[model samples]
Target: MLLCWRDVLLPEGEHVTEKVVRSSTMMRVVIVEDEGITRKWIKKKIEDLGMGFVVEGVFSNGSQALEYMNSHDTDVVFTDIQMPVMDGLELLEQIQAMEKQPYKVILSAYDEFCYARRAMKLGAQEFVLKPEITEESLRSILEEARKFQDQRNTLDQERLKSEGESWEASMRQLIRRAGDPDDIELIRQLEEQGIFLSFPDMILVDIFFDGVIRKKLALELLNLFLEQEQTKGTAFSCSEQEFVIFYAYEDHENSLKQVQKLRKVLKSHMGVEVYLGVSRRKQDCGWGKMYRQASMACENRRFFSIPGCQSYESMRITAEGNPSEFCFFQNIKQIGVFLGQRQYTEAQIAVERLLEAVGEAVYLYPAYVKTMCNEFLVLYLHEIWKYDLTEEEKGGTGAVELLFEQAASHFHLLKEDVLKAVSYMTQLLKRKSGINGCSAPVQEIIKYIEEHYAERISLAQISDSIYLSQSYASTLFKKETGKKFSSYLQEVRLEKSCEMLLDSRISIQEIAVRTGFFDAAHFSRVFKEWYGLSPAEYRKRIILQKGNRIIQ
Candidate 1:
């Protein structure tokens, strides 16, 4: 019958030979079958055809074929219906899901034609029955697949031209703008461009670097690392200073290591401080939330975190219940007290602990934490305003507030900037004291008080330091400064003690000893008399204000 068919027709026309020449170039093929003999037979037959299709790979099952597909550019996949590990249907589904979908064909027995139909529905272009697998039948399927590949290649080129503009905008809207993923118009547009997201969970990794990063170098590093990990993640430069990668949560840990390594390599090679933030493995269309978590964690640069790598899981604060409101309120109040007493060091310490506590509260109670931080900022500003400050000092206060406002979601950075503002305020106070209208003797006395406030300062010692009798030095101090020697000394001592309470986490008893109080009990009594709270109570109040102020 074969000889008779060959004798029945003769090819004619230039188009016939041209077509044959065109189809002669090899098309890369991968064959998947559970039976080794059948797989080898199919591979050899495709190679022997000496036409367009050539078997580049032969796998005993679909899983192996899928692995090969990861690194190799496969033009067509010819797979059997049933196989171990991954079935032909599963392979076809994944291939269709790929950004560059390959042509698929099915080989099945007549009894399994129903499965072949399902495979066709899953994006298989053709099916060849096993018993009828002749050279002619095989060539017919391959020719059809080649045509399908040509059509797809043309469409892909057109898509690429528009995809950069359209899909990038769509991605920015979805991930950066927090646009609704369920928006009908958005879904329609993305579908038109064949951008589909099937996974319910996503892992977001944000990269941050100081100064401008070369985009070409940055993308080169990202692609190298992702390809090495064999990840299907997508990345884009969100801004000049930031780049973000979105990967499946199924490969979260592996992707995480890849991103971390990418961070280090960029730093070592580029000589830039590159930081990475990894979001918690989250479910649903959580790209925005994960982006914030990862980016902020990297930006925070907290003490407990390594500057180059921080994960949301590592930086997140966990509380079994809401932190005590009384604690947070007390801390804020203590910060006020420290500021009022001109103890900026202590104020800075109190603010640090306070921010850390609120940082933990942010996840469970965002609104509450925001209110407390704002209120605390107001308190800090009020305390600084009590003194006559220059315009520069006033501007410093405004800058601190602005910094806090900018770091609304990032408590660690807010804490650092606030501390710097308070320190600047303290310097202003010191300068103000220096230019006071007090006489030289009194100015010397004030200097002595500042330097020796933490020592066993006595009137005899104060006068002796300047070679004057106690009574004469006392009169000179009062006449010049309007405050008596003992009163001025007490004021200086108490102020210094308040500074110690705020600046250090030392025990109150130890603080009393260091700050020149012979008796811890007496120090607490005096501290209460001045600030209306014991030292220990003040410290606890500063650290525990997160829950209390929020509740109020």
Candidate 2:
């Protein structure tokens, strides 16, 4: 018998085989043999040897093996030499032609020695004879093949590591070159590489770390952020212990909101403290302005004194107005600052004080009170919207509703009454503002006119009610509401005239006195301007429309 062993077989197979096979750390294997009985025997032997190989796949013939290889991945392949149409040699050739080839072994009968030799030349890892195969021989061959696979894997891993380092270096170079450029050429490059970079605005985030480990943790946290598809425009670079990220968003305020969200993500995920800064640019401003604003925002992070976001908008002091009248504005500003600092309790107290102050101001200036209240309501709603309440918590009845109720009660403004009043005011302002060449003061004058329209009224009387100089109010009322004060009062009087006209029992002369018109002729002229008909003609048209509806 000519004894042929591809690699040295283990001499003490019974002693070391079980220990090696039972070990947790071992490579996986696949077996391809045409003979079902032989395949079963081989599988049994592999398991019995207690070697650590996990047989992930077993196929009957070479064609089936090839099909399996195409769809599945394995660490090692065990193939029969002389099976059917697509034999071990053809399968080996196919694997070698692939972009990433797997390790291979040949198992054949003694008569196939010549074929096995050819397989070796074609990069078959090792060959084993079937009939005389022993546990010892199998273990040694697998050991040698495992060693070769480890060496190849190490080389491949090193190549990948080198490529990753080069790619990271390229990203840093692109970021550095992007500085001071009129447009970001790197964005075009990234897009060409199938990465998107367009955003309505960009926010630069700089995270400073105290130690190397914390710095790496920060970078990892930012990597998690990039995984979100909505954050595609974001890019990051790390230098030593500092990580800089450029986050892109559609809105300027949205970028600031993202920074606030990032702080919570960092604290919860990484257990690391970080300071964030944001700056925004308009969509048309180009990348140059974006980079400058972001850089400035990052530089300002040092002044925050704690982990938080510093934005360009947060730094400026708003211009002050009358000290006593605008005291509530100052209080709201302080409340906003407290909210920015994450001091919810202090912020709520400030909001309460602002509500109280506005209440006093409204009592002192009842004529202009609605305007003041409307402005404060807008501010209060905006701040409430800014609170970090979840969607579910804010739905139906929640903190927002409670705060609104508090605001109404504090100002002694009835909810139903205020809503009705605001609706009327909004309609009057909408019409007045939409008219050609209307001034803001005209809406105020119109408001005054409506309140006193049922009383004895004149342009001078209406102007005095709202405390505007009569001539100024008169000119503004005409410009804004698109009608002279006298004409607007006449229209109001004529509309009331129509309501009385509908009564059928009331005389036209009595309607004139009731709606603030001087006499029936004056009411007729005004009603004619308003309805394009005299009062009697207007009453007849209404009567005809109503009678026809009743008949139908």
Candidate 3:
């Protein structure tokens, strides 16, 4: 009625009992009897009881049953003492030597009480003299085995837990991490035939999860898998949702497949997607460097938009070249021209094309994407700001920083942000311009500029007076005059200055002040640049020419 477990008191005054059976599974039975009729009859009785025992193998001799049980799982072995080649007692001894020995039971039809005592001494759970064995007795034996297995499993788990803590403490001496168990959990040190990894020859794998999960359950499942696979490595929790695995140098191909299988196991158990980052063994690479590389690869999955895995060696990196130096200056220049001419659609297209080109690049390095987007943004801001003649834009930073807030590390997000910003700039330019045209609006801008030439005129002031936006006023004036608004205004100021100079009554300083040249020095500089003579020299020469013509 009870499992044959002889308990001994431990130092803590607790009794350590029997071992081996999963109570949840049906108890497996192997019957070994020399008489075929007795073996069949006993097997029929046990199976007919409908108890939690299933007769897996029925053998004519102990040797046959032992061979089967060695390779297969046999929770309970029912054998007769007398058989050919191998007898029941010898079989029980051999089963005891096996790693996972099943519960032993001796079966005999004869009244050999001595054989029963010998089988009990040899660690047999029950000795059944056949013809006396009944269904109720078999049920009691099955229930006892299940109960003992459950108790043993509990003790084993407790032992493993205590040992696991000691293992973690030992690992702490090796890894200098911030003292948070959720941040770092050191597992047992895995030992194998040949693995010290003294040289720089270990592949580090980092696992990343998107959100929080129960780390204890997750990591235990991973540990069980590693044990079953006979994988030798040091594993630890890097964070609540991230783990690290270090393997001695095997080829990356095998390591990759193994890691992929690990991923599958985790997914099957937890129903969560795991992103992986792997680091290869490189020359002179130390632990800190490798850890950083694996961490970088893991985090970069989001920016790079790769869902599964990324290895450091797989990334295309040109060590000598600078990613920030990747240029799209010509596109930037063309965009400026488009904005200046009120080509909003063209400007938008240019922006999209530029970003598309960046996206089309062979390798999307996170740093390069960031650098390229930043450069594109700055250059584009400066470019488009040229066309925005609003008084505020002229004085302020002109959306360089306002648009920069949208910058992101993700390629698609960055591209979307850049396109939106460019589109915004385009719309703003268009709104300021009011309408894109070559005729009436341009003539209005021209008249306004000509009339206001003498009194510190600017496109912003002129556009305000004429009820037009600064951007539209400037663009329209350029289209009408085949020159920029500033150049035309300067020419108008100089023409007025020249007319004043012909009178000779006004001093150069007075002429400069009246014509909005700011000073006589400015007047002279403009005159020399345009006509190769200073203002004073030009005035004297003109007077001399007039006098000679009058005398003639």
Please rank every candidate by lDDT, starting with the best: 1, 3, 2
Q: Which regions in candidate 3 have their CA more than 4 angstroms from the true location? A: 1-195, 317-347, 353-363, 391-409, 429-552
Query: How far out, in Å, is residue 211 in model 1?
Result: 2.6
Give the per-residue lDDT of model 1 (tens digit) for 338-424: 766767667777877777666545332232344455666666666556655545456656556544323133344445555556665
State candidate 2's TM-score.
0.28
lDDT of 3: 0.64
Q: What TM-score number comes out for model 3? A: 0.42
Per-model TM values vs. the true structure: 0.39, 0.28, 0.42
Candidate 3 at 486: error in angstroms?
A: 28
Clashing pairs in 3: none
Please provide, for model 3 over 50-148, each residue's C-alpha lDDT reduced to its tens digit, 9 standing for 90 to 100.
Answer: 777877777666666666665456777788888877988898888887755677778777787888787878889888777777778777777777676
Best by TM-score: 3
TM-score for candidate 1 = 0.39
lDDT of each: 0.64, 0.57, 0.64
| Candidate 2 C-alpha lDDT tens digits along 177-256 | 35333445566655654455444455566654433445556667786786762665444544554556665566644666
For model 1, the run of ten residues with the poorest summed lDDT: 1-10
